[model samples]
Structures are given as C-alpha cells and as structure tokens.
Target chain A: MFVQATESSTGVSHDVARLGRLVRGLPETALVVDAITGLGTTDLQPDEWGLDIVIGGSQKALMVPPGLAFLGVSEKAWKLIERSKLPRFYFNLARERKAQSKSEVSFTPATTLVVALHTALEYIRSMGREKLIANAAMLAEATRAAASALGLGLFAESSPANALTAVSAPAGMDSGAIIKELRARFGAIVANGQGSMKGKIFRIAHLGYYDAPDMFALIASLEIVLTKLGHTCELGAGVARAQEVYLGFVEQEAQAAQAGRP
Target chain B: MFVQATESSTGVSHDVARLGRLVRGLPETALVVDAITGLGTTDLQPDEWGLDIVIGGSQKALMVPPGLAFLGVSEKAWKLIERSKLPRFYFNLARERKAQSKSEVSFTPATTLVVALHTALEYIRSMGREKLIANAAMLAEATRAAASALGLGLFAESSPANALTAVSAPAGMDSGAIIKELRARFGAIVANGQGSMKGKIFRIAHLGYYDAPDMFALIASLEIVLTKLGHTCELGAGVARAQEVYLGFVEQEAQAAQAGRP
Candidate 1:
C-alpha cells in the first residue's frame, strides 16, 4: 500500500505525474490510496491518475464538516479488500461499501455531518469535477507566483500540492509569528508548517470555496505582514504576480483548446 | 480497562451517584476515563462525577466540526501517563498535556476545527454549564415520556441516555424508514440504531444547541411519522407529554433548591 496525499496547495502538477510513474512501477503494491492529494487545489479525476483508491475527508478540499471519509475504490482495490487484513473495526472499507449499495452507512453514521458532506459533494459534482480541479490548480499557481514575487521561497522545493502553497519566511523573520499576526490582525485563517518545519514555514490554502479575489486579498494581506515584520517586499509585486499567473493559465488552456481542433 | 460512558445525555444527579459507585469498584483501574456519553447535551461537573479523564469530541453536543477532541485529565491519570506504553503516536496524552500547559496543541492541530470547537464551547460556557445540562435533560426526559405515550419503546430499555432518546420502531415498520422519513419529509435529522440494532431502532437527539421547542418539534414529527406508517398515534400527544416532563424537571429543581436553602 502506497499512501500519497494530494497536497498541491500551490498547484504543483509534477507530483501527481511523479506518483503515476511510481504506481506503475510497483508490482506487489495492491493499492494506491490518494489521500485527496492528486486533486491538488483542483479536484483531479480518479481515472486520469489511474489510481486504485482515492480517500477524501469532508474537511479539506471538500469544504464541509469533518466526519465522513469518501473513498473511490477501483476494481483492483475492491478485489484485494477480500484479502487485506488491517484491523479496522470502525473504518472498515467492506462494510462501508456494502452500506453504500443501499445508499446507507454501515455504522450509526454521523447523521448531520454526512448530510453536510453529501450537500458539499453534490455542489462539487454540479460544478463539474474537471472545472473544479482546474480552478484549484489555477488558484495554487497564482498564489505560488505571488509568494515568489515577494522574495519568499516555497517550502516544497519541488512538486508542491495545488491545495496550499507553503511559503518560507525571509531570513531572520519567524514564519510562526507571521501566521499569528495574520490570524490576530486580519482574522484570516491560514496554515503553518507541519511536522519538523513548524517555525520555518507558513501555508496559504487556496482550496475549496475560494476564488481569484480571495487570493488577491490574501496576497495583499501577506504583503502587509511581510513589511510589518521588517521584510523588504514590493507593495504590489505579490498581487501582480498572482494576476500574471492567472492570465497565463487562461491563455494556456485556450491555446490547448485551439490546438485540439481537428 | 472498564470504560463507562455517562449513561444519560443530561445525566441526573442520581446518575452521577451511580457512576461514582461504578468507578470506586474497579481495582487496578489506574484511570477512570469519562466519555460522558450525554455530557454534551446534559449538565456535568468533572468534579461531581469523580472523573479522572473526561473525553469529549466536537460533533454531538458541541455543534462544530468533528476533528477536535478535548480531554480533561485528573492528577491520577497524569501520574499513570508516566507508565502508559500503548503505541499511541497520534493521540499521545503526555504530549497534549505539555502543550496544554502552554495553551497550545501538541501536533499539527486541526486549526479550523479547533476554532469551531472553541466557538461552540464558548456558547455552552456562556449559557452556564449547569443550565445547559439541565436543559438537555429536561428535553431528553420529555422526549422519552412522549415517545412512550405514543406506543413506542425505549431501546436502551433500562437506562436511556438523556442526550438522545433511542426508540425501537413498531414491529412492522422499518426503523431505517422512520429515520429516512424524518429527514426527507420533516427536514429533521434523527439518529438510527448503532452497532447491532441497525434498522431496528431510531434515535432522537435533544442535546446541545437544542431546547424544549426542538424536542417537542421532533416528538410531533415522530407522531406524524407513526400515523402515516399505520401506527395509532394522536398528533400533539407526544409533544404534550414532553412538555409535562420539562415542567416537572423545573419544579423538581426548584423544590431541591428551596430545601437546600441557607
């Protein structure tokens, strides 16, 4: 089992492709579980990645209450579940699958949270999964470019997730302090470094339920935070970079469409 | 380890005494962890229950996202922590204690969910913990009496949790069907039987973020459901019974206060 999380907060597309190659190479690995990582900020198609199992939670890119976990199982993984012996009393994939056939849950499901998750998924499906993924990727690309223009580096040196763009604080500035200031002064909820990089980096999420304007506002806020924290960053540089990335994405997609014309 | 979740959602003063006896009986029971089953919907004092570790999650009575888990540990539990070696990497109680000392979280905490949990807890604290529990118990008591009057039987039979009333559906009717109808027709969400009782019983929750009106509303909805499904039930009977329970609870509390007056 290979567990790969879709973490493209800044729309790094390379990681998904890299994962595809890794999955193709592993023969003994019965399942490849994408922990909503392939979607990046944009919701990626399961078929597109050729993944066996895609595990998604309600809170992340789904933008709903956190109770339900959605798993899209491939035929291969489904067959292997019969032999997979992980001690799962509550999160049993087989039980959930059986219940799902009748539009029900195996356990006494969290009624209210499941309802919320259902509603959120419905909205995402209605928006068209392709479009949602594209929007997320575009948002991530824009955010990353904006952060780069501010002279701050990204946490993931390569192959970043499109859901959030982890930005490094300039030399001598504390990323933790910047996160606190952003929350205290602006009331904007952004993420910080996880695991070993707690004070070394900060994260800006551009996932579900966000737009271009939100990104622009966030960039502007970051610029202020950088300046107040004694970091020398051009006032409009971040926003301008974000705009450039957005325009570039639109142009590339348009060109691709024109090229596909028979 | 004998885990005894508090029986009632709004556990009565008598329930606390019962729990005390249960806790005192166990030997080598280094920890008395209180899941406080109905604590969210009912009133509780950690001190009153003689709880060594009180555990709570954000979904039930604390109307918030589900990622946050709160634990209030006693000195005895803290001392035992020096000996616990149960391969717990994610939920390390000792790490959490250290973080709490500095008013922080041990791991990469679910920042958004914690914010939501804080808001919900604040709402409860503002309403007054005693009043909140009393209100939940009153509503639950009413729900139970109303359910019984309507020819329904309690599922937990001998000891029903006050946070939610679980009722066994009539022999011919599917409990799942009743649960589905309550949500589909009345836009009300009720719980279904958990574990072994799936499809056999339905639950009506009347805990946090609820009042007498809410409980009565569910009772009235249940009556409609019973009538439509061929059970003999008069509309308003359940609601009236629930109302009587609420009034009785208030009167009893008033009498107890008067008797203990200085």
Candidate 2:
C-alpha cells in the first residue's frame, strides 16, 4: 500500500516506521513497496524500516533534471519477481538491478542528467541528511507562520509539509491569475492547487537549496499579489512572522548542538 | 504511440497527419494519453494531430530539474471527466487545467525547477526552434560519424535518434567500468547501456546548449577510453570524422536555404 505524501515532508521518520509495522502485520510473507513520494525530500532508510523496495527519481530533493529513477529492492521482492508475470520492458526492475550492480543502467540513461544528479548528490552528502531535513522543516515552519500572518489559510492544516507550503486563495481571486502574474511580472513562479482545490489555493516551495532569504523574496511577491487582488492584510507582517520562526529554529538547532556535549 | 526522441537537447518533428491516422485506427478511445517518451524533446502538436492529450516533464528538452510533469489536453479529453475513473489525486489533469488557465500549477510545483524551466524555455525561444533542432541533429550526426570512424557499432541501426548516440562496447571491456573510469579520472560522464544492453554498449548525449566542440571533446574521451581498454583504433580518426560531419552539416543548411530562394 502506497501512502501518498500529501504534506508530511518533515521526514518520513514516523510515517515510514508506521507503514513498516502495518505492512509487516499483514499475513503475506513479503511486502513490496514504492517509496517514491517523499524519499529524497524526507529522511528515509529502507533498511531500517524493512521496506522491500524504495524507488527514487533524480528530480525533487535530489535537485537535478528528470530522466533517471533509482530503486532499491530487498531479497524477498527479488524472489517474487521470478514468478511474477507483468509485461515489463522499459521500467524493468530486474534488469536495472543487474546493471546497477556493475555501476551501469539498463538503457541509454540520460547522461547529462546523471552528471547533474551526481553533482547534486555530492552536495547533499556534504550538507548531511539530518541538517537537510532540519533546514527543510525550518523553512516550512517559517512559511506557514508567514501565511497565517497574511490571513491566508493553510491548505494542509493538519499535517503541514516541509517540502512546500499550500495556502488558500483569497475570496474570489483566481490562484492561476496570481501565479501567472508572478511569472510574467516578478518572474517568480509558485504552484496552484491540485485536484478538488484547483484555483482555490497556491503553494510556495522551500525544499532544496533554499534559505530564509528565499522565503522573504517569496513573501514579498505574495504581498504584491494579495495587494493587487485587494486582499486586506498588513504589509511586511507575513515576512516578520516568518523571520521569527526562522530565528526560533536557528536557536533551537544551536541549543541542540550545545547540549550534545562531548 | 509515443516515440522516444534521440535528440537529447531538443525535440524532433513528427508527421502529425500520419500519427492522427494511427490513433484513429485504435479500437477504443484512449482516456489518458501519456506522451511521456517524446513530448518535451520533440515538437508535437497534439491538438492538430487528433491527440487527446500531450504530456511533458520539466527535464529533457525543457532543460530544468525533473520533478514537474506537464500535461496539455484537448476539448475531447476534458469530456472524459464524466465517465473516466483513475485513482489520481496529484496528477489530475482537470484540476491542473483549471489552475493553469490562471497560470498556476495544481500542486506544490518544484520552485527551483520552475524557475530553471522558465529560463530554459526563454533561452530556447531566443535561439529559435528551427535553429535549435538543427543544432541538435548536427551534433548527433557528428557524434555518430566519429564513433563509426573508431570502428564502434551504432546501437540503433534503424531510425537512429538524434537525441543521443548509443555505441557498442569493445570486445573485451566492460562499458560500465569504462564509464566509471571516465567519470572518476577525467570528470567526463558518458552513459552505459541500460536494461538488456547493460555493459554491452554505451551512449553519448549531444543535446541542450552543446555544440560541435563539445562533441569533439566527447569523441576525444572515447579515444582515451578505447586506448586504455586495449582496443586498437586510429588516434585522430574520430576527431577527423566529427569535423567532417560538422562542416558538411553547415554546408547543407546553407545550400538548403539558398535553394529556397524564389
């Protein structure tokens, strides 16, 4: 069973472990999984969770062009593959496994993309996984506080995601129009709502390679958009709230490090 | 019938009328047409070709980080909403369309990627579509000729793609190992055979913002790889062949324009 990562990007730490227990509780001897959604953006360890298969695409938290999808499979899943019969050609996991063992791919892999992926991964490694997750979560907290200050409702109110922030559009204002204006005017591009919420909300990403300043720029543009749409809210209020959240996170991080005395 | 493009840097032009005829011949109406393999790299007018939808991702020819996928649907596709049922929440087309009309995305679109894509698209527009395609094709031709001169076999014997060139691995060397060494020692990343052809062949990409000189550099790397692998081939043959192809392409383009004169 695939657990869609709607807005739980802080780290799959809790959900993934819960999923592992649930899957293992089933009567089946083995379980196969596709952990593509929040794999890179969140902290994930397939081995730790006993996940059978963990798939990842080169984009997203990996910070590279698409074209490459990486998968990690367990021994139990490997055995089932011999008996399973599904028409597989391009996305053949078996062949990919064999090739990847020798540091290769199963087809004409996207070379340039792989190069960029390599570079991006190197960056991730240098930053450290724990720090990356912390950074993403901090950004999310800051953005959420800022959105609240602007009187914009958080779309995913219950379980906020660190990958991005989704805020409801003001009454009668088209989310698409705001997005278009951002692109056309300020050259800032944000996301709109999906599925049932289309045109009702917009999203701001603060995932990879982003910081407090990035959030400020985004909030500034958002203020312009909200003002243009006649949404009454105090200017700079949102940014100030976000700044406070950011400062709190930094302080907490410093305290944690200090408490871990040698 | 989504055809994969060989031109890694750009999209190719397919005969729209013929494709329309092929789709019309199908027994049932395809609900969600996934043009995943070719849309971004090739120039396709789904609306004109009787296609219900056209899909693309931010990477490939779009020249952006890969997390975003794009879909363009026709009027007929929109009509499928009443009867169609696919378990889709994130990649829902209708909701995205509604939001897109206002120039927004249906979900938390990758901000960094969106920014990069916008930059890439504008860059393409500046280069002009015709010039971009021509440049991509020319680079592919140069790569193929150079590889051929070095006694390397082309992987795709028929309808070889202009996106990238796939070459057979030499008799006694592992293409994957060769790839690793090239990347590790020289900082040049070439691709190894994917899927069924793993370790049997290698691929070289000549797309997006690359030129003949870049292709020349790749060919030189190939020579070094071959020599180190104990494969006997003329030292400068590949480079010479690449130069000839580049020169020939420029001449042909000039001649074609001249012939178009009234």
> Which residue segments of model 2 deviate by more than 4 Å?
A6-14, A27-37, B1-262
lDDT for each residue of candidate 2 in B1-262, tens digit (9 for 90 to 100): 4533233322223454466667655644532444443443345566666766666666555566555666766666677653578656665677777888889766554455667778888998897766766776788788878888898887775656555677787777788987987887678887777557789878776556677888888788778878888888998899999899899998998899899998
Collision count of model 1: 21
Instruction: Give the Cα error of residue A83 in candidate 1, in Å.
Output: 2.4
**On residues A137-163, what C-alpha lDDT tens digit does candidate 1 reach at each position?**
788888888888899898775867777
- Give candidate 2's root-mean-square deviation (CA, Å): 7.9
Positional deviation of residue B152's Cα in model 2 after best superposition, in angstroms: 14
> Model 1's lDDT to the true fold?
0.72
TM-score of every candidate relative to the true structure: 0.72, 0.58
Question: Scored by CA lDDT, what does every candidate get?
Answer: 0.72, 0.71
How well is each residue in B1-262 modelled by candidate 1, as lDDT tens digits? 3344544322222355456456645544544545545556545566665666777776667777445557787666677786887656556888877788889866545566667777877887887777777777778778778888898887666666667777889988889888888889999998777667778888777667788777777888889988988889889988888888888888998998899998
Best candidate, TM-score: 1
